[model samples]
Target: MSVTYLEAIREAQAYLLEHDSRVYIYGQDVGAFGGAFKATKHLANRFPGRVIDAPISEDAMIGSAVGAAIEGMRPIIEIQFADFSTVGLNQVVNQAATLFWRTETPCPITLRLPSGGTSGGGPFHSQCLESIYAHFPGLVVCTPATVEDAYSMLIESVTLDDPVIFCEHKYLYYHLKAESLPKDALPLGKARIARAGRDCTVVTYSAMLHECLEAAEEMSAEGIELEVVDLRTVKPLDTDTIIASVARTGRLLCAAEGWPWGGVNAEVISRVVAEGFNLLDAPPQRINAKDTPIPYHPKLWSVHRPAAASIMAAVRNVLRS
Candidate 1:
């Protein structure tokens, strides 16, 4: 049976709860309501007290999780949506993120953010905040693009000593699938070459990876082979793999679902220009969502985010440069 990206996440959480007594899930409606997306469906019944729900306050939820982590409990917090996480930004970026650095105590907390855009989700519900969270020093921001990465990276995040921002794309929850759960996975912070090519390199993560792959296939028909790199974690970026990919292709294009200003794509291009200037045959470019709040209308939203057509156009521009 094919396991979807959402299922892999649930399985990973189940595995963590079953094996680790210190691991518990905390969020609003996470206990019985099964989360806004049902990622924790029936988990409360299986784990009982371990999957307890919290009040609607995001700040309170994060604060409690941070406290739990400091006391040796590994807390997995499920924020209802990525945008809502801003309500508890202080606890996340200041408290949980700096806990270990300040007190030399490992704060092992996994903050699961249901990220990315979905139809009619609008500005409040549809947001990709990975770049914002990744800007922090101590947070490990993971953006899993596939089912296997979704499962393994989450498990790995809880096991780590630092705080983790698990940005599981909302759009990929049911759309992406795998043949089975992963027994072994690439280490976190490693970039995978989703599709290898020599004409150009496309560095992307989360739901954007699939868009890049589609663009790559279209370019291949025109005899242009675009190398697609899936960045599993935005923070602790795998610069080595990215530079190596650029070394071979000599042209780079970074794509993301977030806005254009100082985002993950911007960072990718900045690193390439700064560290591997000699590897470029052309100027690095990036594509992101327009600098405006996400629209509610489906037609407008369709053109608002980067898609295969836009990605292909960007690739063509990079090739010409």
Candidate 2:
């Protein structure tokens, strides 16, 4: 059955709840009102005691999740908007992320963040803040692009012993669909090659994966065989996959929905420069959000994001360079 991004998330929650007794979910409006985006709609009714409504405090919610995980309970905490997670930075970096490396204790909290721009949510609600969490050690970060991936990897995140920041692109909630999940669902700590080609490799994740795929199709018409790599997991990056793919294509472009400066693309490019520099036919290029707050105006919003046209242009430029 074809599914939306919202449904994919609900399915994942159901799967986790049924598979493990220790797993539970809670966040703002998650109980009686469903979620702000209705991703967790009907979960409270279906699971009863398992789905909880949280008070209006991101820091408190995260702190409670950290404590729950430490006591052998698997908990998933959702920050209503990715921007709200700023209120919980102390719990994420200083607490949850450091527990393992500091005291040899396990933290299995899953921090689910709905991020990205496109809904005219303005600067506050539409920020893509995965780069902030990626900067910290001992935290695994993931952003899924497809509905199947959205379902599978979420289940995978629940089984991991480490804390994870799972960033779901809000713009993609209903923008794409897929028939069904793979029988052998994708595991954490791995990347998927979305489209295979011998020309240039377009490395991206989350909402930008759709842009890169569209660009790849457009590039095909112009005789440019583009390979698209969905770096499913940003933290604990699968650099080996990136290096090998770049080695085959001899050119690389890292695209993301976040701002260009210190974005995930920066890390991807740095990895290429560090390990795959010898395989590059040209310097790595980046097609990312313009270095500014996400504008509220529709026209300006269009210009602020990295679209297929921009990615295609970058591919052509890199090929000629």
Candidate 3:
């Protein structure tokens, strides 16, 4: 009786709709078509008028949701892909982000991004925009890896005052599962230590967390312990936990599915060197997707993003240094 990451998300939305009348679902084909990924399957029928579909315009979808949120409604806008969310950048960054500060009215909007690269998705459909949205002032960026967090975090997101970027990895929708939905979860902005070790630290989130865990387990066979930390939410990153983990491990390796430049990996490495430089025995390293657009070919896509083999190689490098 395992619940998948996709199912967990559907359940979470169902819970929100049942519990909170203020909550509603809005996005392309979400009402009758059940969304492109079927994340909203049967939701339109169950919730009738509440689950409404919007025009094809991403900017308009977000703009209306932002306005609805400001008027005391909590709207969840589902972007078909994380890459497509860029179309609504102005509404997200300019309107939803600063509404609370500029007008004193909380804009509680949750933007669900079907994020991360999958085989055949290519560059247009595959992208990790968590780091980009996290850069904004009034946005809370969440990268949920586990089914538990997927269910719990989304429910929490719509309730918050600030706009939330929900980065749900497309790769994990069916691949990751749990025995039961979580009743309660680690609060947003808290990092979870997935595995404990003293040799080195691998800080990661979302789908990359699973890959890092696999690498850590493989390295254990060689007596090279790798501590794995899962940063549940990227914005308001839990630096205290990350710094403390590096202090114990004496080495750091930041990993993410996004590109290396100005991404979560860069931020983690920068923080460690800036705040916990004395604790490290070697220079902090980071593993990221190659600096190129995601390719359509399976072979090319396989190597484009960080994988277990790549992460293992990275840990071995940290150990050597």
- The lDDT per prediction is 0.94, 0.89, 0.93
Rank by lDDT, descending?
1, 3, 2
Candidate 3 per-residue C-alpha lDDT over 18-89 given as tens digits, one digit per residue, 9 for 90 to 100: 899999999989988999988999998989898998888999999999989878999999998999999999
Q: What lDDT is obtained when candidate 3 is compared to the true structure?
A: 0.93
Candidate 3 regions off by >4 Å? Answer: none
Question: Best-fitting candidate, measured by lDDT?
Answer: 1
Candidates in descending TM-score order: 1, 3, 2
Report the Cα lDDT for candidate 2: 0.89
Instruction: Write candidate 2's Cα lDDT for 1-321 as tens digits.
Output: 688887898889888988898899989999878899887888888888988999999999999999999899999998899999999999999999999999898999998899989657888888988889999998999998888888888888888999999999988898678786556766887999999999999999999999889989987987889999999989888999999999999999999988888868999999899988999999999988887888898888887898888888898889999
Q: Cα deviation in Å at residue 261, candidate 1?
A: 0.7
Window of ten residues with lowest summed lDDT in model 2: 177-186
Per-model tally of clashing residue pairs: 0, 0, 0
Residue 117 error for model 3, in Å?
Answer: 0.7
lDDT of 3 at 300: 97
The alpha-carbon deviation from the true structure for residue 249 of candidate 2, after best TM-score superposition, in angstroms, is: 1.2
The TM-score between candidate 3 and the true structure equals 0.99
Give the per-residue Cα lDDT of candidate 3 at 122: 96
Q: Lowest-lDDT window of 10 residues in candidate 3?
A: 47-56
Model 2: per-residue Cα lDDT at residue 158 = 83
The window of 10 residues in a row where model 1 has the poorest summed lDDT is 97-106
